[model samples]
Target: MKKGTELSGLINKVKESPKTLQKISPIKPTKDETQFSFWIEKMLLKDFKLIAIKEDISLKDLITKCIKEYIKEK
Candidate 1:
C-alpha cells in the first residue's frame, strides 16, 4: 500500500473513535512531604531494604537520613 493511503486510513480510523474525558486526582503536598520517583537497580533496592531492616527504621526514614547525610558531606 502507498504511504499516503495508509496515513489516510489511520486518520479516518482515529476520527471514527470516541473520545472520553478522564478525571484526574490532584496531589496535595503536606508540610514536610513531597512525591518523587526515580529508577534504581534491583540489587541496590534490595540492599537498601536490608540495611533499613537491620537498623530497625522505616525505609522512608532510612532514605531521608542518607540524603541528609549526603547533603551535609557536600
Candidate 2:
C-alpha cells in the first residue's frame, strides 16, 4: 500500500474505535505546591513506579508522601 493509503487506513480505524482511546484528565496542582522536576537513576525510577502501581496510588502522590515522611523523620 502507498504511504497515504496506509495513513488513511490507520486514521479510519482510530475514528471507528472510540473504545481504544482513553481520556486523560489533567493533574491539578495543590495550592501550596508548585511544579518541580528532577532526575533519578533509571532503575530507581522504575522501582518507584512499580511501588506506586502496587500501592494503587499515583506516582506523584507516592513521591509527595515519601518526601513528607523523610522531612518528618529528619
Q: Give the TM-score of candidate 1.
A: 0.57
Candidate with maximal TM-score = 2
TM-score of each: 0.57, 0.58
Candidate 1 yields a Cα-based lDDT of 0.90
Counting clashing residue pairs in each candidate, in order, gives 0, 0
C-alpha displacement of 24 in model 2, angstroms?
20
Each model's lDDT comes to 0.90, 0.92
Query: Model 1: runs farther than 4 Å from truth?
Result: 1-30
Candidate 1: the clashing residue pairs are none
Per residue, candidate 2 scores C-alpha lDDT tens digits across 32-56 of 7788999899999999999999999
Q: List the residue pairs that clash in candidate 2.
A: none
The most accurate candidate by lDDT is: 2
Give the lDDT of residue 33 in candidate 1: 84
